[model samples]
Structure formats: structure tokens, C-alpha cells
Target: MTENMNDQLDASATFSIELTCPIGLENVLENELHELGLTNTRLGEAQVKLTCDLRGIYLACLWSRVATRVMLPLTHFNMDSADDLYQGVKSIEWSDHLSVHSTIAIDCHGTNKEIRNTQFGALKTKDAIADYFVEKSGQRPNVEKQQPDVRIAVRVKREKVTVSLDLSGDSLHKRGYRQQGGMAPLKENLAAGMLLRAGWSKNSQFSQLVDPMCGSGTFLVEAALISLNIAPGLRRQYWGFKGWKQHDHRLWQQLQDFAKNERVSVDDLTVTFQGTDREQKAIAAARENIKRAGLTGIVEVSLSAFQEHDFSWQGSTPLVIVNPPYGERLGDEMALISLYSQLGYWVTENALGGVCALLTSNDQLARQVPIRPEKHTRILNGGLECRFYLFPVVEGSIKRGDRQQAVMSQGAQMFANRLQKNVKKFKKWLAADKVSCYRVYDADMPEYAVAIDMYDDWAHVQEYQAPKSVDEEKARVRLMEIVTAIPSALNIPETNVVVKHRQRQSGKQQYEKVATSQHEMIVQEHGCDFIVNLKDYLDTGLFLDHRPVRKYIQDNANGVRFLNLFCYTASASVHAGQGGARSTLSVDMSNTYVDWARRNIELNEFSDRDHGVVRADCFEWLRKSTNEFDFIFMDPPTFSNSKKMSNVLDIQRDHVELIDLAMARLSDGGQLVFSNNYRRFVLDSELSERYVVKDITAQTLDPDFQRNNRIHQCWVFQKRG
Candidate 1:
């Protein structure tokens, strides 16, 4: 334990302090105290008992945000009844903490009690203190509830009463910036606590911070203040110690001077903090709150929808903290789901080396984002069960070769061993089920879990487990053995086996370039060819998950004019054109990708007269093009707020509008296919009346990615004749 010279105790000074914290957060508080090297600590229900002279109390008050109140514990005694409570209160030496001329007040609450009434307990305790003073000094202190010199509190829990003096006059949550309220304003202390728990620190030069859904700017404001070493309680006008008889004026002045000197100017730090909200009124309120905190110049607030903004951080790794809508209220669930899906799209498109901390109560919405978070912490906000998920953004597209295959190879071995044992049990279970494709047993047992999908003579088996360490070569070999054993266990020959090793990528390095090429033309699985340029990217091939949809296009196309909106590589259009379409037009914003789409059409041997690639915004192109098409494919990014596009695109929320636009260009009896990658997609119920909607997820899922249904629903909507 490191002793603070300033916090040295004097034997002549005798004092007891009571620290109050949130009920369930006592463990967190205790760990903090332990880290601070505070000695002789005792934990009670929502409180910690520590004895220190004046210096310890000051240190605790200055640094501990979790402590609701720092108190001087005057007495602790058994109080079985009202009479006992009154007698116990009278026995305390009140003169030590309160002057005869000062006003006093009593507050009391009971937990497990013989005296169940809190009002009766407060009145009895007040009487005992008042009568004792009157009898001894011939005068009693006035009871001032609003503003008291010495506030005494009695807490009765489980047949025990502990009396203490409140050192903090008001709740510690009043950090003093919020003069007016906005929608869903988070408590100041709770916000600070959340940031601290997330391991954010001033030492790290994280210059950029953004809160896309900044409701009341709680996260942004706190981040700024903490980075600048600003005292959270400096703006407050009162402390509970002001009324105490032994309140040291010299010590208080010294502490204030230290706090002022330690304060760092926000301008001195290269910190960029901004918050945005869709509601103009909320943005205005956040601006006002930022100004009140004396951080107007350091923090910026804007009226912007989350899906319509592109976040660019100029630092090494930016931190984005967002508390999105949780859909607790009716009519908000659908909107929130749409918002979350769009948020995921934005994260995948932009945000490199940046970390995102998304706070959400819905686990389903959290899964809508394609990438899984590295860590998650369960927290409570106003009785709502929420999780703070942390994801680290890599620089480029993720590839199998970019990852350390050694680790994955080892991980695969362990996964294979687990698969072997599960295959034996699954074979027995398969005999009972009449349906061959149905799920046999789906259970995750930490280190090992298996899911087997049987199709005809062939079965696709996937095994999941934690990745292996760098030097675990033996584990890798053992994993291969286990994988080989699975076939034998299932009564299949080793010659009929196909094995794959999958490694988890590190968040920061997941997207590095693996294969180098300026441009490459590759044949698709179905014999059609598509061209991709990988000079500036790691991925030059098709996303295999969309194989089913491409096949759908090829099977249905014949003498039809096909329109592909938001076409990235134009793979679908090439397939449509190869399927004997009269002509195909592909629209995309990226000129680089538009060229690649043109190459794909040429690679597939589709004549120039039958295919055309347009470099323009898809939505705008769709609105202006008068040419009608018999077939249309609209597979826009799940969410995008790019500068090139005026309106943000959210598949779940804007699908109806997008379908309407596509329908305008569809000839009578023309079919429009809409697809998205949001894992937990929900179609708008109103669309059922306009066009036939169907969930083609089961049909679209490829064998390579079997754990979850990655690609969303593919609905075919035909224009009414």
C-alpha cells in the first residue's frame, strides 16, 4: 500500500467516515478502494466503513465518484424499538460534529424493522437529539430540513441502526451542468461511471470521440471533462461538511486550490468531441448543456440523423460511444431495429481502427450488425437490463489468408476433436428424426460445440471453439486428427472428407490486404464470370453467401430488360445478361466499382449492346430513368450515410420507399428482388398488402456459413397488371 504524504493521520484527530455507493456496485467500489490502497475497509449493504482523520475523508471526497456520500459515522448501536432508537441517538456526542448555534435536521429510513414507520423513526431521533441539547446547554438547535448545518441519518436494516453525519449535502449525481432537460437525459454519475468502467483514460491520446445518438450529450461531455482533468463537482455550490462544527476552513481551501491548479485547459489537449441527434430540439439542448459546462469550444453538437452522417476520426483510433433507442415503448421497436441495422452498415463501411461501444437492451438488435463484438458487459440503467458491447474496427476487408493461419489451424484441431464426439451422438439422434435437414442438437459448451446439416449423401459439419495460442503446433495436429476421426465416427470413409480450418481475426488486423492485384477476373461457381480489383482492397472475389440469389436471377431471366440498383460489382446483372436478358443496366456511385462491373459484363462475354454500367447514385438514377425493365435486383448496403448519397439508406426502415421506386420502373408482370444482409431483419407488415413478400433466407443460406443465416430475406414483388 502506497501512503499519501498529504493523507497522513494525526492521533489527536479522531473521526469515522461512512461511504455510500450503489447497492449492487459495492464490489466495483471495493476494488477501486483496494487499488487506491485504502486500508481497514469494511463493506456493508450499499456502504463501506472506513475510519480516517480529516485527510482520508478529503481524499475520498475528492476522488471517489462512485461514493454517493462521505459521512462521519458518529454512532452504531442496536435499536429494536422507537424508544431504543431515541435513546441511542441521545447518547452520541453531537457537539463534536454540530455547534450549539447551528441548525440541525434528521433523515431516517428502515429496512427490516420493529419500528417500520420511517416518519416515526425520524421524529423520535430528532426528539432525542433536541432534548439532550436543551437539557445540557439550555437551548436546542433549530431543525432546518431545507438547509441544515448538521444532517443526521439513521438507517435501519435487518434489526441494526447506524447513525452517521452526511458530508455531501446532496446526491453526488448532481454534477451541475443540466439546468434544463432533454429527451432521455442520462444521470451524470451513471454516465461517468460507465466511462470509467469502459477503461477510458486521459493518458491515451484518443483525440476524437463521437456519440451518434447523443440524447443529452452525456458521453461526449463526460469524455471531454475527464480528458481535461476537470473536477466534476467544481460547479456545485454546497457540501454537507459546511455545517459541521469541525469543518476545517484551511483544509477545504487547500483542496480547492489543488483542484484549480490541477485543472487542464480543454484547448491544450488535441481532443475533438462531437455529438449528433436527429431531434433538433435535443441537439439544441445538448449545445446548451455543453456551454454550461464551460466546454462550448471543445465540444460540438449537430442536428443530424445517425444514418445520414459519415464519421471520420483524425486520430489513431477513435472511440464512438452510442446509447441508441432500446424500443421499450410501443411503436418504437420497428424504428429502433431499423436504426440499429443502419448503424451496423455504417460501422462496416467506415470506421477503421476505431472502437464502438453500443449500449442496447435488445440482444436481437445487437446481432443485426454483421460483426460480433469482442467483449460485452452487463449494466443496469434505471432498472433496464442493458449490455455495453465493444467492437474493434479493422482497417480493410477480412480475409482467411490475412489471419495467422497457425492459430486458426490449432483452433481447428480442437474444434475437430469436439466435432468427433458430437458426430457420434448426432448420428444416433438423426435416426429418430424423419426430416433429414432438421436440427439435431444445438448446444454451445464453451470449448466445444457442433452443428451438423445433412443433405442427401453429404453432410456439412461445423465446429466452434476458442482460438489457439501462437506456439500450439501440437494442438493443431491434434485438431486435424480429431477432424479426421469425425468421418470414421459417422461411418464415412476418410477419402470422402473435406476439412477447412477457420481462425478468428484480431479486431485491429482483421481487414489487411492478403492477395495483391490491380484487377482480376474470376469465374463464378455457376460458370458466369465477374471481375474484381484488389489493388486497393483485400477482397477481389464474390461474396459466396449471395450465390442463391444469383442463381435465382439466371433461372428467371429471358428476353427481359434487367435493372440492378446499388450495384457494387454488377455480378447479378452479368448473371442476368448471361441468362439471355435483352439488356441490363447497372447503377452504382463508385466509379472504380462501376468500371469493375463493366469488366464483369465483358468477362462473362455479354455483348456491350446487351449491358450498360452507369456511374451515378442508384436512387437518383432510378428516379430519372424512364426505361422499364421486366426484372430488377435492389441489394443496397444495409446502412449507409455517405456524402455521395443525400438520403441515408436503412434496409428495414426504407425498404418500402425503395420498393416503391423500383416498382415504378417495373413493367407489368415484372418481378423486383430486394435483399439485405441484416441478420435479424424484419419486413414491414404494410408491404404485404402491396406485393407478395416471402422470407427466402433458408433457401439462400450457403453451406460455407451455416451457424447463422447471414443474408436476410429476398422478397420477390411483382407489379400488378
Candidate 2:
């Protein structure tokens, strides 16, 4: 058998081979096969087909890093039923490929109407092989699943079936280095693919490689092996060809010896590796994996967070790569935004003139990174779709500390000039009124459509949604320009700016918390104290546009019972309490806003007996209450379909009904104030005839909101005598 096998594997004999890999890795696998000297190649979905001799096949199994399996084709036929499948598999000369003494297993994939499923197909193929051996030699090979001596692969695509021998006994991703893996650990071949995509090579200019979130040290070990020219499968103990009639043992041994000789010594390696993880257990696992891969001294790991990790190693242009938690299996996504931001900041500060690559499954989290990646590719890791972002840093560019002095584009400089002028105009009023928060710009330039609000030293930049007619790439570039100009124009730190996309929101979206950072602070407006959170929600606790309306309520609140409806965070209620109102009642349906209102009341040191915050739908509460109040303020959302509400509220459609409900509980001599931010609201004509109505929209506009008169509309109503 051995002599015959050797003769069959001569220089003129070649076989058609197919290498299968994970989805999105076909191109990488093809490149690896090319490096292994397999020339006649064709690419398919998640696979590469090639023509190579037996020595070439053995060489690929030993050196192809990104291929999951190396398979040698045996036969191809059409099968419409189970019997056809059995006969097709049996028709292959089984004795030439396998002996009765060898143990075999069948790995099947796909199915058809007749095959039904993969398990049934595998079972039928196994029986066919067993019956063939029995009929030929009067004996059958035993079936082995775990450690099969000869593994046959049977794939059915509708009526078409292709059978091959899995030359790789086990998946090539099991590089034999990782005894255990951490949560959602990246497969070794996938890691190698990512490195290739990021342009990491032995002959590349990068002098060092680092993985800050190095779970089990997969990236570090793979990087070292690739740079050292060590064959990935050199340490693997078994192969499916071990018992095959055609496997040339002497030729395989010669290939292994040549691969061993090609490997570079640790001392001669040009690139260095470093890794760190916040979890001690992960560091421990990475240490074990590094040692197992024979890279104890060459690669090092320590217990530290990515931010505090020592990136000060002496080298030419270091490469920083990380696979941070994507918030899928670990924790809440809102909190992970800060983590990505910090990682981005670290890279911008430390990785000058090098490269930074990050792998994440969340798109929202990916945007939190301050710098925009030049290239991003879609890939899959452990069945979850992910994006691999690559950012190349040029020296003396993109350092966060130097962002203020960085050169700006022509349009961005114009935006900065306009912002500075607006700040200068507001300086006197802001100082005299002691207002710590106010809007500085409301899309003054048509090209740059964004609103800039200043809360002391911090800037809240909201970009209005661009029209569909506009190019998305152009809009994105303009928004980036606006954000980049704000910090330098306002003389504030870049980290103090938060950017959000703004569009028309319906239902409870306006009140929903988008992030868990909870970056809140207190600001004073007209001698009234209030708590404002700028990050968690769409609208901050205090609406700067309503400053004049709240002031009017406070001045007239003296010696009156004040009724505050739809009181979000109760900022107006706080002002009324400070104005010595006899008592104040605030109502809202959301529990989150209700709790926030109570905290604002407490912040003002108001007595609980005199100040009240109720969590109830204003419409329902008004219908149930018979009590009358002398002073009332109603501010309803433009549109809400909140589940807690008894009915959807559209201010434009339901304003008449809502006003009547509030008026039923209003005292005869009391003044009722109604306000809405809807730009196109028209009051009912019949209400003007029933009660005296006055439009106070013009009077309610403060200096900061004078440019946009339609920011809000206000009206006062009183019962006719």
C-alpha cells in the first residue's frame, strides 16, 4: 500500500482541492493559499478551490492560517433520494481511499427534500461506506466521531451532491495553543484574517503590536507567529490523511522539516508584542495561552485597564488593536459609550504615526469614538456581524490636546467665526442675568445646520437631520466640521462636547434616556435653582427657550394656588415655590420625569406639604379632579402616544379638548396659561368668543431666542363675565 501511494503522488499527478473558511474570509484564505504556492485558484462563497499536488496539499494543511478545512475531492453526482445518495457514495472506489482496518466518520452539510437533514445524510453515507468495505473484504471499519482516522465530507445542494475527504481532521482554527477561551473569544483564524485586513505583515513598517483588551491573547500570539514565519499547524498532532491509502508519510515529514527550518528565532524577530486586560482572570488566561504558544518572553501581559495600560514602549510606529466588549454579553450599551470614547481618546493621544484597529458589533457605540476611521469593513466573529475600523495616525495630527490649534477647513473656519460672534453678543446679557445655560447658535448658516447650546464650559451640539435631497457624505462632512470648530471657537476642552442627531420625535422617544452617563449639573435662572442632565435625555431638565415663560409664572404666583400641568422636571414649579405661592401641584405621566421633578423640588429646599409632584396623565387627572386653582400653567407635548396615557395626545388636534378639561378645574378669577412648541399651531376661533384670549408669544421670547420666534407659542385665557 505504501509503495503504491508513493508512486501515485508523483510530480505529474495533481488533485483538485477546496479550502473552506468562515464567511467573509474567502479573500484572506485565497491570499494565504497563494503564499503557500497553490496557483490554479478560484474563489467561491466562503471557500477557495485550487489544483495542487500531494506535496502542495500537505504544505497548505501546515501553513494556511485562515482556512478552516483542506478537503480533497472524491466524486460529484446528482442525487434525488436516499438510495441515490448511498449508491453515489458507494460508487467511489472506497478501498483505494480507506482500508477495513481504519476508523471513519462522515461529516455532512446542507440538505434537500429527499435528504431531509444533515444527520440523516451523514448516517446514510456512513452505512454506504461500511457496506462497501464489508462486501469487498468481508469486514467493516469502526465508526469514530471524535478522532476519526478518515473523515468523509458529504454536501448536498438540492439534487447535487459533492463528496470529499476532509484532509484536516480538526478545524484549523483550533491552533492547539488555546486550552480555554474567554467570553465571546475570537477564533484564531478570524484573528489572523483581521490582522491581514489591517495590513500587519512581517515585512511591514510596524515595529510593535499591542492588544489592550487582549482576551486569552489570541491577537498577540497570532501576531508573533505570523511575524516569526512559524507554520500554524506545526504542533497539531493528528490529520485525517494519517490512515488514508494515498497519504505520503515521508513527503509530509520532509515538508514539516522544511517549515521548521524556515521559522525565525525569537531573538531575530523584528516586531515586539504587548497585551493588557482589565480582568485579572483574562490576564491569567492570556499568560497561559502565550506560554503554550512558546512566546513567554517575546510577548507580555499585565492586569490593567486600557487607559492605564503602558503604551510608552520604545519602538517605531506601534500598532494598537483591541476587541472591546460590544455590550452584547457583558453590560448595558449606554455605559459602554464612555468606554469606547475613552479608548478613542487614548489612541488619539498615544498612537501617533501608527495604526489603531477596533472590532465592535454595535454601530452606535462605534460612533462614540472621536476620530473617524478611514476604512471600515464588515466581518463576522462568532456568528455576530461586526465592523472592523482602521485608523492610521500621522505624526503631529489628531492629538486631542492640540485639537484647538489644529488647522480647520474653509467652511469650518467660517462656522467658528459665526459661533464666536454669537458668544460675544450674549456675553453682556449672560453676565448680567447670571444665566449659566443658554443657546448660542440656532442654524444661523444654512450650510451648517446645527444648534449649539452652552452649559457653562460644556457644549451640547445637536445636528438637525439633513434633507434627503442632500448627499449623505457631504452632510456628514459638514457635521464633523461643525463639531471640530466648536471646541476651538469656544475655548473649551474637546472632551466637554457631546454631539447628537436631531429629528422629529413622536411618542415617548423625546423622554427616553439614550445614555447612562448621567452627566448632570445645576444652573441658576432668575434666582431659581434647577438640576439639568445634558447627556441622558433629549431635552435637558430646564428648557432654555421657556426662560421668559417661567419668569412670568413666578412673578404672578404670589399669594395664589399654582397648578403646573405636564410639568417636566418641575422647573416652573420650583420658580413658583420660590415666589411664595400658597401651594404648588406638578403633574406628569412618566415616572422617570416624576422622580426627577421631586429631586428638583428637594434641590430648592421646598417643603413637601407645600409642593407636590404627581405621576399621572394630565388628561385623566383633570377629568377626575373637582378642586379649583387660582393660577394654572399647561405645557403639552406636540405629539405623544405613550402607553401610560389613556389616549394619544396631538396638541394640534386635541388642544381644544385639553384646554376645556383644564378650564373645568380653573377658578373663575384665575389666569390660565397654555403653551406648545408646535410651529404651525392655530387656536380654535370659538374659544376666543367664550373667553378673553391674549397671545403672549412675542413677549415670551428672551434675548437668546429672539432669532427663532416660533420656538414656542404662549396664550392666556380668562372666563368671560
What value of lDDT does candidate 2 attain over all alpha carbons? 0.84
TM-score of each: 0.52, 0.72
lDDT of 1 by residue, 525-637 (tens): 46576554323343343555677788789888989999999887889997897788899999988766787788888877887786988888778887787888999998877
Model 2 over residues 376-400: C-alpha lDDT tens digits? 8787887888998887776433434
Error of 1 at 719 (Å): 39
Number of the top lDDT candidate: 2
Give me the displacement of residue 125 in model 1, in angstroms.
1.8
> Cα-based RMSD of the predictions, in order?
17.8, 6.7
Which clashing pairs does model 2 show?
none
Cα deviation of 481, candidate 2, in Å? 4.5
Off by over 4 Å in 1: 1-16, 23-51, 394-721
